[model samples]
Target chain A: MSITFKLDVLKPHQPNSPTLARALKQIEGVKYVNIRVEEIDQKTTSIIIFIRGNEGLLLDKIVEVLDGNNCALHSVDEVTIQDD
Target chain B: MSITFKLDVLKPHQPNSPTLARALKQIEGVKYVNIRVEEIDQKTTSIIIFIRGNEGLLLDKIVEVLDGNNCALHSVDEVTIQDD
Candidate 1:
């Protein structure tokens, strides 16, 4: 069975770094790792990552990757264009 | 007012293409463009592009850009891990 997870990340200072990519694939549950560059301010390339994986394991791996990379993930905002 | 638009794209075969990057910035309503490399399959590097722009104009420009780039975006899934 396959499942998808929303994983948005910010790469403000490192857009071409493959280090994060390598670490993400090391996780056990991650099936796909999609990266989207969302915002750039001053010197940051904010990005979003979409992944497919087992829920618990994916979250665990996220934590591990964040720790290893010394980066932090953002809380997803459930902002739907609700009334139109 | 400022807003964020989720624009996920698949760059199946070209991860280093800067043309898309350049084209995206030309849209009038676009506030920012972020890219994330989500998956790598054989000869493709699937990526996501997150953007912020005026609702109507953004959609219009997206269509124009897609027409120019020959890419299609997928319907965003409202797949929440509903019950956990």
Candidate 2:
């Protein structure tokens, strides 16, 4: 199975999109990660992240990574699971 | 190159999500299509569509198909192009 997620996140500027993407890519089963900055504030950046991975993809781990980075997950905009 | 698009559309309920997805899959180069209905009014349905395809995917053709189905494209939320 392959799972794809579209997540909205708000985080401080320290871990920019590249940093965030790299961190997420390190997660088990993660195959693709794309982070787009939607808005920028003096201290924070609002971004949309798209991740595609296999069945090993766990939402809990994803959330944990974001939390570790001091990022707040606003919402999970979309999630799709497809059988390979 | 492969492209992914996230589109917001509003249309009558006649051509439901499944119908819409089938139509979109017929487009050249489209490999995956997922449509999720977010809101339902008495006469219309608001949906978010995610499409993945190769370089052959054309935005004009997508819009044309939606227009043919009387769908109003509210916005294109995201677009990503990646080299394969």
Candidate 3:
């Protein structure tokens, strides 16, 4: 089975979005990563993240990467699972 | 606050992936959508979905879209919320 996650994230408005995208794409089974800015505050930026990967989608690993970059996880908006 | 969700989805191997992506992108506050195939069986395909959008992400609407297409949502893998 494969899984996909749609995440809402908050991050400081410094590190480029591509940095986060590259980090997420590096995860095992992660096939694609896309980040879009939702809102821009004075210091923080709200973003939506989309990730596609294999069955064993590592939520923790993704968390670790985001946390390491000082990004906070807000909420999980959607999930989809595929299996034969 | 904005929210993002990573979803694992199951879909039949007929409708093109872009169709789903386009449908998702049409959602309000949905800035981007990415879908990737993980495993392909004889009849089904495992896919991972990533969606980024504003704070008021309507999970039900997304579910409605997937259900309308005969797709099943298996799990929500990740959620990130961004707030100032």
Which of the numbered candidates is closest to the native, going by highest TM-score? 2
TM-score of chain A of 1: 0.66
| Model 3 / residue A59 / CA error / Å | 1.3
Per-model lDDT: 0.54, 0.83, 0.79
Candidate 1 runs further than 4 Å off? A15-17, A77-84, B1-84
**lDDT of candidate 1 over B1-84, digit per residue (tens):** 233445555564642646776678678866677767787778656667766554334354665785577656652211111111
lDDT value, candidate 3, whole model: 0.79
Interface RMSD of each: 10.7, 6.3, 10.3
Best of the candidates, lDDT: 2
Better of 2 and 3 by lDDT: 2
Question: What's the ranking of the predictions by lDDT, best on top?
Answer: 2, 3, 1
lDDT score, candidate 2, position A68: 93
Q: Candidate 1 - CAPRI tier?
A: incorrect
Best by DockQ: 2
Tens-place lDDT per residue, model 2, A1-84, is 577778778999987778889999999889999999899999999999899888668777898999999999875555665546
1 versus 3: better TM-score goes to: 3
List ranges where model 2 is wrong by over 4 Å.
B1-84
Candidate 2 lDDT, B34-76, residue by residue in tens? 7776877889988898988899898899999999888989999
Chain B alone vs. reference chain B, TM-score for every model? 0.67, 0.96, 0.93
How do all models score by TM-score? 0.40, 0.53, 0.50
